[model samples]
Target: MYVARDCYEQGVKDYNSSTNPWLSSPLNFTVSSTQNKFVVVGCDTYAYLSGYQQNESYTTGCASRCESTRFMVNGSCTGVGCCEVDIPKGLKNVTLESRSFQNHTIVENFNPCGYAFISKQDTFNFSIDSLRTLRDQQMMPMVLDWAIGNETCNDVENKSNYICGGNSSCQNSEDGSGYRCKCKDGYDGNPYLSHGCQDIDECQDPSNCNCPGQECINEPGKFTCFCIKGYHLDQSAGVCVPNQSSLQVKLLVGLGTSFGTLFLITISLVLFNAIKKRSETKLKKLFFKKNGGLLLQQQISSNENNVQNITLFNSKELEKATDYFSENRIVGKGGQEADRSLSIYFLHSMEENHLLDILDDRVKKEGDKEEVIIVANLAKRCLHLNGRKRPTMREVAIELQGIRKTSDGQQNYEELQFSRSEEIEHSDVSFTSTGSFSIIASTSSSTVLPLLPFKTI
Candidate 1:
């Protein structure tokens, strides 16, 4: 490293610049001038540079002139506002001085003083503001060329004082006054001491090779690339690529496709079930409207609290509502009844012991007399006026199966149920002007059970 003693009294004129010449180092080299430039900064001044290189003296100077800043460029140091000259090589001691051509009488308003220094050419640039101040800069940097005592490489290569280390070589200095040592190619370090040069591990940087899939092998001061298993280097692409035509790759692709297909099927089934449930709800609503259930619902909701719309119809009223057994209303073209004016008649047949009378002769054959009486008693309990007295479903099934013995006559009882199922579908319903609802259920050919509830359509 080389540093010039650079300083300037901002508003003063008398100053001098010089570098330490008596300094010594392990390599025994002095300050170098080969890498420095003699720089002069002023508008109407001249700067001189004097130095000694290997006992040889030299003197050089450059003059700068600029009237106004209008045409001055900042970085151009070509005799405008700034000027520079290459320093002589092998210079060990330097002195810089400056003098104003007209005592700064013309450009003093813009450039009050002049300056001269030794520095790297790139380290200094002239700007308009530099004329006013330098931001208190005191030191500037330059490059130094180092070498051993005054001797050529051949004069000391084989002597006991030779200093070139392993993997290094000795070379004469640029000024031809001394010699220097350097590490050879593929090696680097201080080359003046024993074992100072070391091999460079190029593999530390993988970019030494263009292939990433290949393994980087580090050799002494060098590197090589080798492909790993399941990979091969492609000459055209200049890179290692994995084998795509392998069974493992095919297996992965097949598994991905199968899972995707199953996901789609599961989604389709979920959508199908949602549509089916929505359609069922819509159908039930349509059937309810067609059966006058909407009007029945409105009548029930509009009634005062503790009010009900259900009305029971007697056997005579049910027969009238069915149009006295007209064939067209039963098994032919369906007709809507318009003559609907009915009086409520809740049946109390069990209290009157009229059980056998409600059974239709067309529906029931001559079954056992004992079974008939047993059935009549069950009906009385199921039809109890107080709902709390009514037998539960479990008790009803137990009583029917326990009280009666199994007989071939059971076939006749089943026949009676099947024959009346068709007649019970459209038994009879009547609505009065007061919005009273009456329904009669035909359990047999002639059996009429009043106020029988049915499930929603």
Candidate 2:
């Protein structure tokens, strides 16, 4: 830090008027605004101080005026005789000018010379007697701002010239240039030297732990408190104790534990039900897709005009109809019987037409025998082992339609026999057949079998 000081004394012949100029070493020094002020003391004294900051020149001053010493107030410089003003920040140089407004003719007998100086604020108190006897004083104390350089905290932290020591942190200067050092939290002392900052033992302070008889453990930067076994803090008393016979405490603890156990059980049950419901839903979806539900929906959609409604059987209904999809409920072999009653009805209708046995009593003599024979033959062809030999559903529909137009039912039966050369004797079609009847399809490599046969009366 650098300070510039000068004084104006009485009887200095060559120095009647004084102008003190303070110049800094470029950016190294500045007049501290926090610690210094511009001051003037004596009757009819005019003082002006000028400085340059950030390339802009500025000036300020104070004037002291009084006719007699009786008008001056001791320890007060409110412009009656002595006056002062604060200095601006970042002032690199300053010039002080002192002048007399009245030529000192009125007060020179009592006050010979006026004094002006820049010094620490509030350091000087005006004395009414000093107006005539202050010529012997040489200099006044002032403060200046100083730092190592213009580098910031971050710029110095990684460099060899960093000044902050261990347990310390760097702080950028308030002027936005240079930096300073200070001890870190939980530590104190000089931060510019090695191992200067030391830890503070917070356990020494009894106020840190509210629990009387609790052990206070001091850590690196903090402290903790713990009670002995079976003892707890009584918050109202701010101390540790064991209340072994309090009914209210026992009741509170019991209620808390009961509520906690009930809460855990409730949560467990809720989670278990959620997981079970999700698993069941997922399994149902998988079964729906596997049982060709999508294909059935597509087919029903395509023929929506002919099929006015599509009914979907849920898992439970299907399970009941197919006897849980067990082999015991299926006729003719291992494939599922989706609707056991519907399958039985289909086979019974075929038997009523004399497809499996003698013709039904109602259709025995009056019904068209040739048409019945034609349908029975077609039904038998559907049970063919080779899929290529079976007629497609479209072809079967066309054949049934042609039977309606035929004058002779035998003609349609012979046409079906000519269309497919597969044999269908009496033994080939029977109600007592046990295994599944494989279909014959010309276009499909995979053969699906019919799983039902019926009883005839």
Candidate 3:
């Protein structure tokens, strides 16, 4: 049951009266329960009640007030002075309204207001002060229905509609309809136990059991167990203990061996890395000296004026930078070298075809290709059989330097003429007439060249 307390705490008064109309009965009823019906007492104010319901919508149940000949002597809403009405059966909610005849012009001085409600009868008692008093001294009690299941326990048990399981029973609902389920007596489990009820084991039950120095065993539908006179079950350990050791010495030995092997492998790796690094350093020094390291350094130091920038790189550095000398990094090496070698054969063939022109023109034309025939002419000129005609190493060096500077965009006619003059001064040996240069002994017994006339034939 539910009780609505504030339905009509204050009395409902007439609109024209000094009391507030908003506090009147009709507004109170609408504010209270929406489903419950109310009865207005103490005056046959039908028109006022009708207007109140019309304002609140008459579709809601109406209120009935007492006749005017019988005034509210006491606070009770009886037939003579108070009023009462039977609330609807399925009443869930309600509201109240109050109105006066002649707009309260007839009885406004004595009966300025009236009361209406659907309240419990015992809580409110009628009093004479209600006629002239401006307030209400009572609260309204309302009844609300509370139900259990929408289905009965019997219906649920028959159709297996309930969820409670394991040692339980169903009971009829206390309310008008439906039912509830609970565990059965002597069983501590769910009701609606269609799945099967589990029996309580009194021997294993903590509250009733006295298994001193014995084991309590739980059975499916019962329980019973006891330790013998000499033995007691260990409840804390949940198992029987035997006084025996179960360990192998070999296990410890194998674990130690595994650790030792791992340590040796780590040491071996460290020593191998150190040795490899030392070997690489020694190899780099060896290659550097073999590849004319000392000679290149001494040449550069002796000829500071002719020195050019030369960079020496370590093999490891080049290999690493070029991804270990990958094939893609080998530019102009394989096919290019083979093509150049073939071109030399082609030049030799052209030389055989026009030997005189190749010699006189100082340039060979081979298959519409302009080729320099300088190397053959220089070899012929340098390898004369007479001692006085071969070109000096100094003259060769100067001419080569002049040619290189000309390629570098340095156009010096004077330097070119000077290089040519030096070559001519030393060009005494004629290779076509003599097979080699003749060595001349000087006064100091050292080989030297005398100043000779520059001639070309």
Candidate 4:
């Protein structure tokens, strides 16, 4: 390196050395550009490096200067006393030339010469001692990069001539001019030779299986540690640990018992509620039939099309409507419909010749007297003691229609006749003294001592 700087006072630029790595036959290698640098070290020295490249020539240069050694740090290359330029990749050759100013005219006693060269980056140390002692060492070490063939890995990867043997992978040279071969993971050897790569017995190495006092078993490309009975491998720690099967079984049992108990309680509550509701519904239906609810429903159904839509209220509905039969709501049998109704009172009044007295004051004042008497007498026939003597709803309707047809004439109700007819529909007229109901339903009703108690619900 000193040869390039051994020159005149002003500047002398010439090639003082040449270095190349490919000259070593059978294993041609290139200087590792990534691992080495073109370095220049001196005060009042400027230098550059030149080399051949694939696309063009490559050149790099650097400069360093320091008035006194005290200003330069021992190992720092900050241009105070040392400078460096990076080597370009794929540089097969390195040449150094230099320019010297003052030529160490002042520091010539101790720092006699300037130095420039391509040295391995890791091995070079720039100390103050290096400035005076570097020349004593004539040779320097550098790293080199190597590969297998001139063709890239991709170009010959599948070809028969591919040099990578078994268990080896091909790698392209960093410079893009060739390729290299390396053993596959877990195998190591010269990958360029057939069967050169061999499996590494990791079990033999103590660091591979860190399970102390345990047997280590080797397998293809890897190893495992054998655990004793009632133990399992702790994957994270790579050690044998006691199994927790007993604890896990206890936990599962506890969870199952709790869930089953809660589930049974829930099912029992639901079943109790469902059975209670069903039994109440069945009892309600039984009482309804016992009270002759069937005949009431049939009568309603038969009359429904000919009159307004009808609604039948259950016991609960009726109780709610009258505020559970509060004493304040009681007026007469008409208002207290729990059992007897106005029909009973009306029949009693008619039998005693007190039909007119039972009529509402407003009805007596506004109604035609003849119609009142006719309707009252009809009601008397309807409440007849013999069920067979009672007129059908159709016959009742016919007689009522006949009364309406003859309303304008001076009616003679004293001679009114009773006759049965087959073809007359019932006429609905004011029956209830108050409320929206057309009529009241009674399961047991009669004023006259009857042949039987009729269920008229």
- Which of the numbered candidates is closest to the native, going by highest TM-score? 1
Per-residue alpha-carbon lDDT of model 4 for 31-101, expressed as tens digits? 68788877777776678777665546677788877667888888888787688878777766556776567
Q: Per-residue CA lDDT of candidate 1, range 312-341, in tens?
A: 565589789888767546421235343111
Identify the runs in model 4 with alpha carbons over 4 angstroms from their true place: 1-3, 7-28, 211-215, 225-228, 233-240, 245-457
Q: lDDT of each model, Cα atoms only?
A: 0.64, 0.68, 0.47, 0.66
Give candidate 2 regions above 4 Å deviation: 1-27, 200-457
Residue-level lDDT of model 3, residues 1-457, one tens digit each, is 1211111112443333322122233211322233333444444232122123323333233333443544445555555644455443322223344544444445444445555545444555556554444234344454444334566766776674566676666666442354556766556654554655666777645754354445667766556666644445577954333222212345666888999999999999999999999998888778769978778888788865465776766768898877798764553222356654654544464446543343434333332121133334444445444536767766656554543443332223335445655665699533421221111112113312222232222
Could you give candidate 2's per-residue lDDT for residues 358-432 as a string of tens digits? 457787666676556666667656655466887877668777666655534344445655444343353465422
Which pairs of residues collide in model 2? 332-434, 332-435, 332-436, 333-436, 387-440, 387-441, 390-440
Which consecutive 10 residues in model 1 have the weakest lDDT in total?
Answer: 338-347
TM-score of 2: 0.43
lDDT of 2: 0.68
Per-residue lDDT of 285 in model 2: 84
Which of the two, 2 or 3, has more lDDT? 2
Task: Provide the RMSD of all predictions against the true structure, rounded to 1 decimal.
Answer: 19.1, 26.3, 20.6, 22.3
Per-prediction TM-score to the true structure, in the order listed:
0.48, 0.43, 0.25, 0.46
Give per-residue lDDT, candidate 3, residue 420: 56
Off by over 4 Å in 1: 1-34, 52-57, 73-79, 121-125, 134-139, 229-457
Select the stronger candidate by TM-score from 2 and 4: 4
